[model samples]
Target: MSRQGRPQDTRKVSGELFSLTYGALVAQLVRDYEKDEEVNQQLDKMGYNIGVRLIEDFFARSQQGRCHDFAQAADVLTKVGFKMFLGVVPTVANWSAKGDEFSLILDQNPLVDFVELPETHQGLLYSNIICGVIRGALEMVQLEVKVWFVQDQLRGSDSTEIRVKFLKKLEDAVPAGED
Candidate 1:
């Protein structure tokens, strides 16, 4: 209900808020960009920016420590992160032999509720922002990763599957002028 779902919060935003806000933002992006590819890129960029901030708040509120490995990261993502933010925990599957890649099957996507992609946006992945969010969030915790939507229910697919590939851990660099 509440965007952050704080424990003491009794008030809640309408369920349609997520869908309507996303739809309106996408529509505006399409109008302003005038190209599906550009719109998708912009959406991803926007999502990345949001993710960068969201992770901080998530960490502060969830009080979760650093993930030791990709497996632990995946568990935290699907079990804790998704449940807290989206109110639904996606199923994680299709793990790679090396355990560096896996797919999250989203049985329900609040961002796509009561929405339909028009013919003009045929190639658009409406829920691509979620991929960007995952990548951005992981990057903040020093985990460099690549995330994309493999299947989208908005495009008439049976389910939404987001594929995440763990690339490498990024090192923290000190600023030249900093202590």
Candidate 2:
């Protein structure tokens, strides 16, 4: 049983199965959307929804507490979060002098294990969902952040890099009647 008193599936998921499933979803989205930008937005939205829920599971499974700062948050996300979910630990690099921003260099993106972006879909961010996931997860922790794909292997980049910028921490809201 999991910490939440739920049964956990210990079965390991095949990487190929995961990749093919994601590919099919992207393909369907491309067919449904008229523009690549729209597809990217849709994918991000999907990831956001997933992230919102996934964070709860992450905490339950990992037994981690709140992050004290953006730098720590980035470290935990790359070291623990990515490893838990995607089976990859991205290298955190390219920090801004202000320490408000950094980049995650993914050596291998499992989501793109068997993906090849067609020439017509150059503008499409095939892994934009990752950005959304990071943004959504951070938001849940009261950390407002901006995430984007700076470079993509599918887009001919030598490596996959996701850039994250910390915006601000969200303040707790008072109840309407108590304020």
Candidate 3:
């Protein structure tokens, strides 16, 4: 199920398919790297590229028919995106009336469960892919945004926060043919 008044893509791609896709990606990376050192660097680089392409489809596939209003957009982002991607829809709270600032509260994180960070990477963030996704997606809408994860006290150290700051909003100009 999706947001009310929203168009849905009901095509279900199974977990196996995703695994195959990821496997293929890693295989390609290994071939391209020709060495272990390059493979690690390329994996993170691939995450950025994945983030870029995912954002394009995320908007068109999820938000295309829904309300373009900021509040509604935030709702869809939290409710729909969380369920499909992470299997947990986060609680949306502390919304600014001006619609400029908001917080994403993740009660359950699929990425962090049973995960421990190494000493060299204690500040190691798991969902950096999402950060890149937000950056790429907002850039497309002409809204330059900075997105980062924050740890809130209430949920203890395991909690995750995605803070989005709108640097600019898109101003769509009318086309001549439309007039």
lDDT, candidates in the order shown: 0.84, 0.87, 0.58
**Tens-digit per-residue lDDT, 121-179, candidate 2:** 99999999998888877778878889899999899999999999989888983222210
Model 1 lDDT per residue over 1-179, tens place: 45475565544565698789989998888889877888878878877877777787788779898788899999999899988888889999999999999999999888988889987788888888888788778878888899988888888889889999999888993222111
TM-score of each: 0.89, 0.90, 0.60
lDDT, candidate 3, at 42: 52
Best by lDDT: 2
lDDT: worst 10-residue window of model 2: 170-179
Query: Per-residue CA lDDT of candidate 3, range 2-73, in tens?
Result: 558866657655455654565555556556756544554555444545555565567665655544666676
Candidate order by TM-score, decreasing, is 2, 1, 3
lDDT for 128 (candidate 3) = 53
Which residue pairs in model 1 clash with each other?
none
